[model samples]
Target chain A: MLLCGLTLLHALVSGSVPIPFATVLQLLGGQAADPAAGQLQTIILQLRLPRALAAMVTGGLLAMAGAYMQVLLRNPLADPYVLGVSGGAAIGALLALMLGLGSSLVSGGALFGALASMLLVFGLSHRHNNWYSEQLLLTGIVVATGWGALISFILAISPDQQLRGMLFWLMGDMSHSDTPTLEAMLLLVCVIISLPLATRLNLYAQGPMRAASLGVAVQPLQWTIFVIASIMTATAVQLAGAIGFIGLVIPHIMRRVVGADHRILIPASALGGAILLLLADTLARTVFTPMQLPTGVLTAMLGVPLFLYLLNKGRRT
Target chain B: MTVLSCQQLQLNVPGKTLVSGLDWDIEAGQFWLVIGRNGSGKTTLLQTLAGLRPAAGGEISLHSQPLQQYRRRQIAQRMAILFQHQESGFPITVQESALAGRHPHRGLWDWSDQDQHETVFSALQTMDLASVMQLPVDQLSGGERRRLELATLLIQDPELYLLDEPTNHLDLHHQISTLEHFSGLAAAPQHCVVMASHELNLGLRYCSHVLLLYGNGAWEAGRIDEVIDPERLERLYQHPMTVQPGSHGNIYLPA
Candidate 1:
């Protein structure tokens, strides 16, 4: 959390209207900067501040969600978007874009579609409390493909004007969010996913038979966990477009330290996720001086090498 | 004292009839061993009796109430089962696996309370898994995992125990202890323990009722000596056989 906070602060101060770290700190402390540098300080304090904060929340939410997914499924490859929600959300946003719904409406459309796909999966997965975790897993892939096709169709027909913003947002950017939106997204993430995921998710890692024989209503619990996970993924995808790998990689590392015990692993994973994405976002902005890079690209660039190393280590083990 | 009665039970899986009309009264304080050749429905019958798989042909009643009316959890509170072998999703601690038995007692997403934890601890101790409670299930040797499974069932505190091959891979000491444990349950006049066993000698030595399934699906269920008669035993295994009786009504299975 501290790392994330620091990175956000730095992102604010390092923008075009460069505010010195001291002035940024002073301005954040509720005092005005020197009269000559007021425009520079205000630009950093007002404009870039919300954008940076949005990046932190978006990155944190994605990474935390990814960690939860990997641990819950016991599938190292799992991410927040492993199910169809991301693709479904994308399709909704794509439709909004083609229809000229604007960015504001597109966000809501994506979230709504993501949740709807999740509900469809949940409804289909439950045979009245009979667990179809495997079934749900397979269905997620199929539905994601179904939505991806629709999204592609919309994108092909879309004009260049709408396509430009859509493409940039899809790659994940912080500039899209202002202060109020970022705060609302943060509140939503906290309130919706605040419960102990580690404790509840242990059921899946324990296997269906063992969980059921031990008295867990496997189907209902399995659907509920994944639904919650998908919702978080959908929220993040809606808030900042699709950011990858933080969800896939972070929880796996947390598992190495915590030994797959959800009670200790879940919260630790959330902190790790928040910090890692915050660092990635900061690097994205800093790596290119004038040409701004999407944080998603930076994350992928960083993740590929790290994931390769972990994969080799995992194979050896 | 508690009794488990299965009346005209039929367990069917789609096109196949695993168990066709299994009827028996598993009275309280009796140790029953179900013996069958592979694919002869030993595990299926056990699963049905334990209410893990719903029977298609008949209804099961617990303590005179129809079993279907009661939820799986309500039934689990009164009966516990130990499957032959159950592997978890990954490496789970022996204590965590054992405490899973307290699932029926759990209200919603919560760990075992103080009283429940103590009971589980005692169960672990009884199964000689106290020292390795924190060890992951995948780390334990096969025999140790088997004992850990027994401890899981022990925590249920049920009136009856339904087990499928309770002693699959155990050292002589643990095996004898397991048999002795059931023997004691048989004599206690309160608990009813039913298990599937391939050990004929152990079955004759400990169990009060024996249900035998022949290679071609023929079955004979009754007293030990009655089912263990040389003539019937030879026909079932399709070989020459002899049963040498011990002083205390024990039947020995000699090679």
Candidate 2:
């Protein structure tokens, strides 16, 4: 939480204009009486504040979804995108860009695409009220591959002029995000719904038969996790256009720090994810002064080394 | 009182019918040993009885109600199963793993309180795992893991225990002590146990009843003394058996 606060402050203060810490503090405290407060308020409140909140909520959503996905699939390498959500969202966003749709429409397209992919996976894998984890995972992988092929085909014929915007959306760009009230609400709801299931999820992480023997309704719990994770991944892709590493790595890092009890791990992963993305987004916007790099690129560059170092350190200890 | 009863219970795996038209009633304070050769439906029968799998045909009742009528939580409150294989997919402490047994007893928002912690600690101590309660489960040895699983089942504190090979990975001492513990548990007024095992001597020593699965949809169930003999054992195993009287009981050996 302290890290989240610090990152939020840094994101509000560091930009092209370089607003002073005191001024940022004052603007946040509703004291805008200073003579030069007008422009600073616009920069902090209008521009950076929304982007920072977007990053925070998007990060929390993705990380929580990723944690649940790992348990649901019983695989450490599972991520939010492992189920083809990002692939579907990427196709939607790229198609919107090709059609010269407005930014709002692009987000809408991505959300639609994500939901469609979720339904497809759920439908294909579910049979006779029983879906094995392996069967679901295999179905998702094959569908993701199909979506990957479609994505490549779409990129093949698009005109050169709109290619950059399409690429930005595919790689993840948060510059177009407005105030994140909806996504923030979504993150809160997901956290609330998931916290109650944390204890049950611990038993679930053991195996299905064990969990069932221990009093968990394995089938219903599995279905709930699938739906909840799908919604969260869809929301995150809508907000940030498929930002990658936070969802995959943040849960693992938090697991090492807080242990595997989902009660603590879920909240810790959310905070860790929020901080990492806030820091990365701040760097992505400020490092080059005028030109901005894709947030996904920066997240990968930052997260890969951190994950590898932690994994090695864990092994040594 | 009848703790668990199955009428015309049937169990199958793919194209093979392992057990069929079976009727059995497990009364309170009765310890039943389900003995079968390899490829028989011992595991499948136990799983079906525990509501972990659907029976091919039959009705199972717990406390005079259909097994399917109760919620999973309700069922868990009355019964617990110790599976044959234990796998931990993620890192968890021994204490935490055992504490999961308390899941069905607590409400959704309730955390593990002091009483539950004490219970878990005692259970771990019983399993001789108190000193390493904080260690990760993946770091435990096979025998230690099996004991940990037993400790978890003790913490669950169910009335009906359906244990599949409760002595799979235990050492000789642990095997004897664990069976003794279950035997003691089955002597309680409202408690009963149904275990699957191949240890004829131990089963004869501890269990009051026997369930013999012949691996071809044929089975026999009765008091251990009446249901078990060299002739029945030979037919059950498809091999000649010699029975030797030991100090504790009769031991069956293949000839």
The numbered model that scores best in lDDT is: 2
Cα-based lDDT at residue B115, candidate 2: 70
Candidate 1 per-residue lDDT, tens place, B1-255, comes to 437676777766566665655677777888888876666678877777776676778767788777767766777788887887674575668887777677677665574356577888898898898998877687899999899888878877677888888878988889889888867866786788888887766677778888876534346778775666767666655667655658756464634
Write down the C-alpha DockQ for each prediction.
0.40, 0.87
Worst lDDT run of 10 residues, candidate 2 chain A, spans: A128-137
Q: Backbone clash tally for model 2?
A: 0
Pairs of residues clashing in candidate 1: A66-A247, A131-A219
Tell me each candidate's TM-score: 0.83, 0.98
Candidate lDDT values, in order:
0.71, 0.90
